[model samples]
Target: MSKSKTTIAKPSVLSDFKEITKMRLALSVVFSSLAGYLLGVETVDFKTLTLLAFGGYFMVGASNAFNQIIEKDLDALMDRTKNRPIPAGHMSVNTAFIIATLFTILGIGILYTINKQTAMFGAISIFIYTCMYTPLKTKTPIAVFVGAIPGAIPFMLGWVAATNDFGIEPGTLFALQFFWQFPHFWAIGWFLYDDYKKGGFFMLPTGKQDKGTAVQCIMYTIWTILVSIVPVFGFTGRLQLSVVAMVLVLLAGLWMLYYAIGLFKKMTEKAAKQLMLVSVSYITLVQIIYVVDKFIR
Candidate 1:
């Protein structure tokens, strides 16, 4: 239940949850959904956008909460995640479950107010992230691929929510994000290889940060850039980017690829970190450019 309904939790207990939810990550996911909505809609609806943000945050937060609960044991084994609420004993599993349930209800309900498809996709994201991706981490590197499924949904979910269509337009948005996630995630896997190994999570292909991993990252970065430029060709039914947007997005992609290339050359953690930051910047900038280009042109 919401805080208003239950006895107020202790301050530090609340803080435990705030940390566990990964609020910044949740907000970033919401931003992608908002960008998709902006791009899909002919006339912007603030109400729908607000719903998208809130619903997206709650769903992603719920997924994160459940992931933490499931990974509590593994998290305790990893230095980076050892301080998290569940693994640190700052919060009980039951409390986390309640929070996750409440978020799910609120998220799906809010998205349902917009459309059934939106709500369905939101539920799917949570389910896949928590059920499939969370457990797969310890079993195989393919977990990253599984995780990318739900990770890439927000953008397409926004488009579906706005237009109630799951055609080439939304598919293009999904494709762009889906391919972008590999390079971004592999970079993190490259830097945090040892930390993840402590948790028994094999994120890199071949389970090592070597030429194979770097080569895959480069290939996916190329794929991401190519998909981002697809709208410029006017093949996608309902999506079209101005030539200006294509150029800007290409430049951003290259910026990310530069760091990827750096990682390939040095194979150093520092280079991997640079690639991660550049990937984050590239995605955010591309989303902003897509939305802005929608109106200016």
Candidate 2:
């Protein structure tokens, strides 16, 4: 009986850690940073890449843990978040705070070893996410706009990590991810409108599921697609994409755009969910294509 209890209890503890840190989300953020690093690097340094992966994950994980602590009460009010570690009674706020604090220290320290710019951006991402975005989520829809700042950083952070400089290359990467956030998040807002309302979060621009929201999604999708293709025009300096990669990138964006249009026409929860998934795939595919193009060209 004692052995069984220990075995079962271990998995629960691991699950709580996963919930508190939002493991999947943290990994995806790390992927973006790694992708950015790959794009800017002429010769890969596995040491720096490994540091980036761990440091980026720790940074994002810390932000998420702090966010959960701040929103513990609000999270319990919503179906989606009610099962999180803190709200579900699997972890204490104090414990989460301690974890978050340690992750923040480790994250910043690891990043600082790379360069000042990389560490600075990592610290900035955490501050904006926990201090600004978390608090604003309940008060205004503009929180999404503010939240996009940190969301867009990882991709660009990688470039700075690789080049140790902030230039058109990193700037273009920043612009690409920055514009992509609106449509991606709005689709989530559209689908989870009711759940968000329960937590007093006004996620959509108009705070409702309507054609107006869909129109903005369509508009931002266009902007994201346009920004993505800018590297092919040769103006973005070291971020240039070959014509072949540019065409492939265009097709991927159009695929996402098709789903966005479907959401507009259907105006249904299912359509919104489809758009969200497609947007995720679109970004990941675009990143892969960009890196592949850089190597072949």
Q: How well does candidate 2 match the true structure, expressed as C-alpha RMSD?
A: 2.5
Worst 10-residue lDDT window for candidate 2 reads 1-10
| TM-scores of all predicted structures | 0.95, 0.97
Candidate 2, residue 118: the lDDT equals 100
What does candidate 1's lDDT look like per residue over 137-214, in tens digits? 999999999999999999999999899878999999999999999999999998999999998898998799899999
Q: Which stretches of candidate 1 lie over 4 Å from their true place?
A: 1-11
Give the runs in model 2 whose Cα sits over 4 Å from its true position: 1-7
Candidate 1 Cα deviation (angstroms), residue 167: 0.6
lDDT of 1 at 153: 98
Error of 2 at 288 (Å): 0.3
lDDT of 1: 0.90
